[model samples]
Target chain A: MNEKNTISVATMKRLPLYLSYLQSLSPDAPVNISATSIAAALKLNEVQVRKDLALVSSGGRPKIGYKTVELIADLESCIGSEVLHEAVLVGTGNLGKALLNYNDFGRYGVHIAIAFDQNPENIGNCVNGKEILPCEQMPQVCAQRGIRLGIISVPQGAAQAVCDEMVKSGITAIWNFAHVKLIVPPGVVVLDEHIGTSLPWLVGHLS
Target chain B: MNEKNTISVATMKRLPLYLSYLQSLSPDAPVNISATSIAAALKLNEVQVRKDLALVSSGGRPKIGYKTVELIADLESCIGSEVLHEAVLVGTGNLGKALLNYNDFGRYGVHIAIAFDQNPENIGNCVNGKEILPCEQMPQVCAQRGIRLGIISVPQGAAQAVCDEMVKSGITAIWNFAHVKLIVPPGVVVLDEHIGTSLPWLVGHLS
Candidate 1:
């Protein structure tokens, strides 16, 4: 907590990876682990891992290193993993449904509070225990729930409009899966998950 | 393709974004575009955009900038967007089905030729016109088709096992959606899409 605001985005992203790896360790595994061990396991640089861990946890001793349980608790607290951050998803297509059914988001403290779509047929359906509402209800529902995160899974053409609505509803963070580059106002954070780009990057590497 | 081998991973990743943006432009829009214009649109550095574009295309003029149509073709060829790269996806779960149903991959020249799952109920099912086959047939199908790219959407526990099978079946590149850091040989490439990390990063930034 000492350097919470000072943690770089790169380190912040790696915190989840470290937490997931530590959580994946067996119950019978060693209680104490060195940064070198973690870095080796995750195929990361040892010095970088040490620096990243130091920002979150102060339990690293000279030789004994960090206690697994304490490090996990510190990471969880620092990354806000213990807090339930609610988000509203717009677009109830296959990708939206997959995001709804994705249980891992809960582990990272993200819960898709509701989903919305303009299609009348999709509006009355239930996906992964959450009912789909009409697109008209998005702003009201998000504002009522005090949700700060808005997920845009709609097509490229509708993404900007959906994002504008979310911003108007006071959502500060947007996770955009649409292919287009979203234009957001200042102070609004948008994480564009261009899933299409990953494939080409991989293919281009192979060729 | 003059500096194809010298292109950095960062530039390779950005090529698709640039291509997508260029393709999104209206037909009546300007036929020429400068890196400064692109930088403004995507909120990137002008120098970085120019350097990235220069690596892919030689059509950029000093003042008039690059012609839209020719630049698009050069970007496409550089990113290998014209070649149909066939891939096999493992796991027929919600995420797998979503990827199978995702049509944008075709725009990026990636085709999910087939899918596999261990669940007997899903084995014979068809998702987005691609049939889900039994897990046992994975190696034979991948080998016979000379599949170099493999997608891992299976659960974390089963990921490494499936990755090993894919490597044994002649797959050299893996687009892993599972939350595990896979261990591959020297020549193989693995792109781990850690979708879970994005949410926490967004929440952390907002907090």
Candidate 2:
């Protein structure tokens, strides 16, 4: 939360991936990880990895590379991913259920305390131990819990409405999975995981 | 596919998102969309959007902006997303099932012809009209079908083996959704869709 040098969102988005890769590496002895190894693991250019890491104060040694413990701590604090963030999911669709069932979010400090759905059939149900409540209760629950992150996995048509409700209920950030561009008031950050867009690029490289 | 000035993979990855936004726009008259508008919609910087768009030969007007149709055509051709690419998915897990059920891959020139799973229970099942086969048959099926793009949604432990199988089966590009890093031979592209990593970035912006 410290007001440090502003890091670009692109760089910030990649730091978690780097952290994940570093976490996967077996920590033994000095744990000097080169950017080339990190780049190879994450499918990133080594030069770009070094440049991104340079944004922070820590610099890698010539032969030894970066210290694992220090680099992880720096990145975790830098991205604020170490702090537990309570969040609520707005949809219980297939994608929503997948996200709710995905237990790895805790590693990144994200906890979906509850999920809401407009579908009456899904109300009062539990997914991955998280209760599925009525959509109407979302705003109240979010406001009461002081939840900052609102994840929207509803259909594109319903994404904006859910986003607006989250914003109105004091949610400051949103991780939208829907394919629509949501219009939100200022000071709210919307992180769109456009899972569909990557397919084109993957297909692009084949040719 | 044309041998134009090499575009960065990052830029190539974003072109589909731009095309998606363009596709959503109601093309009325000239449809001159400004970079600022695109940036606001996609949560990108206006300067970055302009710089990215500048990679292509087409330049936008000072105020009139770009022609929507022309931009879409250029991006589609640039990424080769206009042509269909056959792919085989490994792992019939929840994430794999979600991807199989997702019908939007056609828009990005990706078609999941079939899926393979190590789980005996899931081998005979079909998801979203795609048949799920035994993992043992993957290499043969991939080679027979001439599949170039391989999608891996297996768990972290099984991911590398699956990647090796895919590579042996002649798959050049892989779209891995696993939580671990995969090692592949030269000239093989691996696009990792780290679903968990986004949570950290989303939470990061809150602080």
Best by DockQ: 1
Candidate lDDT values, in order? 0.85, 0.79
Error of 1 at B29 (Å): 3.8
Clash pairs (backbone) in predicted model 2? none
Over 4 Å off, model 1 = A2-6, A26-30, B2-6, B26-28
Please write out the lDDT profile of model 1 over residues B67-144, one tens digit for every residue.
999999999887766678889999989889999998777766678999999999998899989999988898899878
Summarize candidate 1's per-residue lDDT along A46-81 as a digit string, tens digits: 999999999889999988999999999998887766
TM score of chain A per candidate: 0.89, 0.84
Error of 2 at A42 (Å): 6.3
CAPRI level of candidate 1: medium
Candidate 2 lDDT by residue in tens digits, B1-207: 333226665666677668778887775744677777889888787898887777753747888778777777777676555567889999887788888988878877889999998788998999989999998898898878888999999988788999999998899999989866678999898887878665655676777
- Candidate RMSDs in Å, in order, are 2.1, 3.5
Write one digit per residue (lDDT tens) for candidate 2, span A27-144: 5644677888778777788899988876753657887778888788777776555478899999887788888888878867888899999899999999889999988887789878
Given the true complex, what DockQ would model 2 score?
0.47
Model 1, residue B52: what's the lDDT? 92
Quote the positional error of residue B50 for candidate 1 in Å.
1.8
Residue B196 in candidate 2, Cα distance off native in Å? 2.1
